[model samples]
Target: MNKPYVIIHTHTSIDGNLDIMDLQAFEEASRQYQELSLDPEKQQFEIQGYLNGKTTTEDNITHYKRPELDENAAPVPEGDYVADPDAPMYYLAMDTRGELAFEENTFGYGGVPSHIVVALTERVSNAYKDFLRKKKISYIIAGKEQIDYDVMLDKFYNLFHIKRMMVGGGGTLNWSIVQNGLVDEVSVILAPIANADPDGHRFFVAKDPYSSIEETSFQLKSVQELEHDTLWIRYSVKKK
Candidate 1:
């Protein structure tokens, strides 16, 4: 059996908002990716901290928050930020499960696992099927009518050669993984800014609260201080 490693790399605010980014937040995420990346050259470029602690915008990224690439396949003409080497295979955009009306997309680089598996239900719409097909994205249906936990894990290890999976959540997907006990660890990067809406969406449970971990605990791994007033802290989840 392959040793599966799970980690959640995320940025949150003091009030638990993970929506938008300021300068420090972006840099910290970039640094984390740089550290986990397999490519050495890309790691060097990302660690320079040039674009550290800045807001992510259209000028810096594409339609999604992905960095805009030039025709030559370079991340940008300005700085040395290189795109993740394994982007094509690993980055997954998770659409709304079953409902084609409001699908979600998640874009990440090489730090993600080998399999970019989207957890979904079986009753997905035709529009979604076409969309995933056109995008050349593979998906897994969990619960009923799709990929369940054991089956998905088997596929991940056997087919995709995935020993580790870093799940960057969009609430529902996060809830799914946590509820299923698929996730083993979580790393939350808390920012200084507070959310404008007190009752707005949070990093974890908002309405349907699940059981908190009983035996699961975490240990501080490391903390990196950036130019901005932000702090990057990593925690290792001590499993039961």
Candidate 2:
């Protein structure tokens, strides 16, 4: 494949909800998830870094605030910017409109440092790009109004040589990549408990009005019992 091999890796309840009912179980499962991401024997591929959706990043990292942008500033040169291509790892964010206000260019994950890379679109203002540049954050421009997953993945591969990428985004972002046929595998750390909240976030959700959910099948690859009654299930997406 010319693009990176994408893996949707997440921890969810047995009912496929993103909410964690049992804090202990969630913490244990999360520990396993981090270990599994670095397990070379289990993954059989080098994981460059993980990707998160814009909303997830904002909720957890940026705290839902807009960056100070100078709309009247001079336009940045066209194309993707590579600030630290030689970093040991990366933390990628899907911010199509460049709304993320990043104060730093690197994030530490599991004691390993990762360079921050923001996925953007042409619709973003020049000031936002300038902000990223000032922070020394690298960014890639894929689509005009929205992100083109194919082009974005290709750029990730060619620019950063990301052979394998871990998709740790929420349900909407997960389903978006899966429906786009860019994901190679699905790895879920199923927590033993389930959350019955009707409004609970699911493992996969269709949020785009223009897109319809297709019935995608997966071939079971492996099942392993983990600590705290959590189960690790791996599935390879069946190509249509």
In terms of lDDT, which candidate is strongest?
A: 2
How high is each candidate's TM-score? 0.56, 0.93
Clashing pairs in 2: none
Candidate 1's residue-wise lDDT over 1-240, tens digit each? 342455555567777766665565556654554454334444322111111001121222232343222223322122111123233334433333433221223333444333224445555544454444334445554345543556555544445445665555544445455556666666666666665776644666522332343334567877876435666677765555
Model 1 Cα shift for residue 2 (angstroms): 6.3
Q: Give the Å error, residue 93, model 2.
A: 0.9
- Pick out the ten consecutive residues of candidate 1 with the lowest summed lDDT: 46-55
- Angstrom error of the Cα, residue 125, model 1: value is 5.5
- The C-alpha stretches of model 1 lying farther than 4 A from their native spots are 1-3, 21-88, 93-117, 125-131, 145-147, 206-217, 238-240
Q: Each candidate's root-mean-square deviation in Å?
A: 11.0, 2.0
Best-fitting candidate, scored by TM-score: 2
Q: Candidate 2: misplaced stretches above 4 Å? A: 38-45, 209-211
